[model samples]
Target: MVQPAQSPEPDRSPGPARSSEPARPSDVPADHVVVLFGATGDLARRKLLPGLFHLARAGLMPRRYRIVGSAPAAEALTDQEFRTHAQQAVAEFGRSRPEGPAWEAFAAGLSFGAADTGAAEPLMAAVREAETALGGTPRRLFHLAVPPVAFTSVIDLLGATGLAADGKVIVEKPFGTDLASARALNAAIHAVFDEARVFRIDHFLGKEAVDNVLALRFANGLFEPLWNRDHISHVQIDVPEHIDIQGRARFFEGTGTFRDMVVTHLFQLLGFIAMEPPVALEAGPLRDEQVKVFHSMRALDPAHVVRGQYGGYRDEQGVDPASDTETFVALRVAIDNWRWSGVPFQLRTGKALAEGRHMVTLGLREPVLRMFPLETRAAAEGRSNELVIDFDDPGSITARFLVKEPGPSMRLADGDMLFNYRTAFSAQNFLEGYEHLLLEAMRGNQSLFTRSDGVERLWEVAAPLLDAPPAVRPYAPGSWGPDGIDGLVAPYRWHLPDRRDATP
Candidate 1:
């Protein structure tokens, strides 16, 4: 039986105001060094280096900070060569290219090392040399941009070489393939670093609007009263991509849509949306609330879930002709708790769909406002009061409400109110999601990172679905997911993007 939603403890209170700007590390460690493990890898080129450059440009780089890139079999790059490489990467991937002086200062802090991270001696020796050059027992941050298989190995190496002292580790997600593996990985990490010293990255949690969910819910009284199962009919969290997997066949094969998106990104979003008000916004309190929600999630019923694969998936390179791997998934999850008991949380993500959107839409139950008359059923149906939070480029919050039409005789029309981040803040405030998260990790702020308990609970909710996956239906590319998903969220069709243009 579902339990009633728990209320906030009497003593619970909002924590310190969340930093409006990116957090700057206090007491810059003279020995601050950021080691990029997969320095020459694709993620480094596309996200890490560009994000670091943006941080430096924002004057958020610590006083003694330096970046040491490492990779086995990678050619050793001199400072200048690395700087040039970074410049190119930033040019290609950054939101905006940096100015000459800003780029130069950031580049001056760059260096490179080549070592097999699996081997303790060579990697440690390279890191030590970088530290010596900086001349301090600098706070070290090791970022693993490599594959998950290498996680334990690199962590073991870090401990064996004594680099784990006064050091922190940043691990990228899809934390583990499943619940059991996630437990093993967490145990391994705990052995090497204190829980407080480990930062797990889930870029979705760091987005500007997503980070504001707590503040929006707790900091204001306007929405809290209506934030329960009583007022919201259903919640839709949909992330659709219009492009095919761009050469990620190998990774995609090991992790389909469920593991890649549903388990990590979708669950983290659920944590924020359903958590009881935290006593404070500090890491511990915030994460505790998240864990509670995860624990409260009811086991997903196979009948309420749907899966699909875009046509031609098997034609993709590295894909098996007999592959039944799902490239798309849609789930209707019920939280077995008071506040969300009957409310179905709809989560769906797919590659090569019609629209490329990352947004959450909350369908509010129509209130008994006698002031507005529903002359027709269609009019009443169209009067859905929705709150949409779009998490993609140019993030925004949109409120759709009903208003009287200009014509006489009390006709009603749908209207929208939008708050776009780009318009509200300066262009500089539009940092890539990774930039904000990487900065927080550097500052040792775990508020935006996932906690171990929350992670395990996430897998617990997802493991059943993975262990016995639903049948995969085929859907054409450039179409909203499998047609059958429409029935899963019956009475409330997907809030799809406009069909004015087919291209992403």
Candidate 2:
């Protein structure tokens, strides 16, 4: 087993002064039934149900576990109808096809119900019947795969139906548009389920390599000693996607790149990179460390931030013709703590970029001139070493180091020591981020989930940009973000990962 960091005790102070139950163990809950709200929705069809099927196929799901899809507008689907829907989802979007034995086995646990978000009694009756059929007081898990606007109503319904008793809830991201709403949502959720029972899901946190960051830094001795500001010059967390907002105009309109990506995904990455060692790797201790890192971060400076919108974003359906909503954002934030005092952590994310690059690069300070001879000194000036942790589809880790050219004459070349997931673990198949996250939720592990305090801190750091928005620069599709973004990294440019090189 990997050992926990020998760090100081985690802060025991309450999060956001909200009422919460004692923390639970990071183990799978027993005899549970997961009720998925908005079950016929796009997310359920594309990711959640397929993830559950994958879990069942791998024998990772609990023996008595059941999945009941519910939607207010959905007609009461027969078990056959629900199983058919699940079959199509897995066949189309799953990691693998739904084979006979595994498909039938997984489909055996499928059921469906109709429950209005505003009225939960019908759902409550259905769940009671499910538990009775399961032959015990099975733990209830409600996954709200619905929109942010429906969150409170669902929570209220869960409570009214008595489904919140000994139940856990999984909430999707964009917890709220801003800090106040986030706090409000937390309060409402807390009223229904305790903090320990709430799982704030951010699928990126469940990625294999994304989780590997903690392992790479903590488990290995080679990187930990050099992880701080003294040895590292800067950190770059870049997440630029190749696709545009053609279909998601309404979502992109309200939630720009900042709220959509930075507040949740990139900030979590920053936490993993900058947090102090945790007392333990349990949910509370780990999240406490992340919350501290967030608290240590200085408010994002506007001057260090740049925003951009794709050229034809305004012409997209449902978007305002005069929309200034940013589809891309690049900003430099400083962690105001001992380990990363002077380091500038540049975070950039956008839509319709050159490639779907998702990686974090730690640029180490250049070595001293005394290490190299006079002849090769010039070539080694700006050739700083960098450690990159990629969160692409299959994931990878790479170290860029300077090496002497084969032909001698003190000539130098940059060589990479790469570790691709496929190259290292060829026998296993890669799971989607949501698949891993959903499995973890079923297993009652909150370590990969976002915490309420962490969300609040993210909003705090992003308050300036949220309050007085920056001018959204217009950039053509298939280009790196606005030209000003290039200046943020100055001597170094963003590392663009080719889609061809990305793992499927």
Candidate 3:
């Protein structure tokens, strides 16, 4: 069934001054304190700090709240200093830094606290101080911006320290290096916080385009009619990046393309794209459906999945002369459910590739009994229709379908039409992944966040390729990908738009 296009309900026109993005429900509550566990790190500086600044600048954050940064030496970093730091990052990061005192007030709420990993004393004390200082009776939220190694200890400590009482920790991806590890990590997190308090993030879920994907299907009458196996042949998702892993040599060295990209971002999105309609758009119902997709995905044996590591793109500083790490991966998966039994989902993602971009492509099954002559069918290449969602491109949603050429010919030709969201609606000045997700968690809106079981299922499905590595294809810098990636789709024959742009 196709999702019908939905009309804005309950005064969708956003109210007030919080976000420039979309107008959220006015009733949306904003009452909570957000603590940053690692406030000095790169992730904190680039994403977390600036994101919090965005929330404050936009008024998405509450007026009565505390912003605490905890890590080693939390006492040394004062509220003013941390706020100033956040201000600078926002100036460097915010798309259009909102003018005036909004920035000032946002920064003022920012505070710094030194948190200890081994013992929760300093951390708990710091938290207590922030609570007391910020006015005392607010909900506590801990954003774990630390690396994976410190996860177990920090979560355990938070529980042992009673920091998780009204706490919520935003866990980053690659939660575990793999499936078994993911399970262990989940267990540790659950030991402290309940499943609801643990928000596993897949940034793509926060992207307007990503969420619209579901809406495009569920809320549209036109697409729902053709959403099933009968109308769709395959789906292709590509997250390509041209940047090599230089600084991330450590992370990438351990996590190849499959673990880094496909497991979290690609599969997470797939679960959303392919899941059945939930009982409601409520968080639990939606996530439950996605979990089913993760469970239904065909288990890819080493043979079914391909892992590729191109030459010359080793550690940025040349850490390893020979890195077996694969910078690229492509796999064909089938969903055995009744709705999409025979459909194929082609999933691929990579960094250090020939491109720096991402997109989701849906190729509808070809129309039957070619009414046109064989010559015409052969020329059109048998593509019934296709829809491509380009995230990094000039940012537009487009449909590739058969339209009669104007005037003469009267022949069916493929013409593309685009629905530019930015052009259609004044693009809402919304927060990026980090800020948006942080606020959602704060508001108890788990709609865009990942569930624990979803994370474990992701690892469970992708774990097979760890040992069953596929052929390592090769591609050059500024190149689309390895020589034969296109041929991999020979069975279904997906259309390559001219030369694949070195970017997604």
Looking at candidate 3, the ten consecutive residues that score lowest on lDDT are 1-10
How much is the lDDT of residue 229 in candidate 3? 85
Q: Report, for all candidates in order, the number of backbone clashes.
A: 5, 1, 23
Best by lDDT: 2
Q: How well is each residue in 1-504 modelled by candidate 1, as lDDT tens digits? A: 111111111111222111135433461223368889888788999999988776665556665567878776545665567778878888898754744555655666677776665554555665666667667466789999988998998888778778788799999988998889999999999999989999999988888888877777898788888899889999999999888888899999889988899888988898899999889888989898888889999877777889999999999999988888899999998888889999989999999998688888889998776676665433545437788888775477777777787876897677777777767765554556788788788778898899888888888887678788888999999998887998888888777434321112
TM-score of 2: 0.90
Give the Cα-based TM-score of candidate 1 against the true structure.
0.90
Instruction: Arrange candidates, best lDDT first.
Output: 2, 1, 3
Q: How do all the candidates rank in terms of TM-score, highest first?
A: 2, 1, 3
TM-score for each predicted model, relative to the true structure = 0.90, 0.90, 0.89
Query: How displaced is residue 497 in candidate 3, in Å?
Result: 4.9
Candidate 2 lDDT at 44 equals: 93
lDDT (0 to 1) per candidate: 0.78, 0.79, 0.70
Q: lDDT tens digits, residues 279-304, model 2?
A: 88888888999999999998888888
Better of 1 and 3 by TM-score: 1
Using TM-score as the measure, the top candidate is: 2
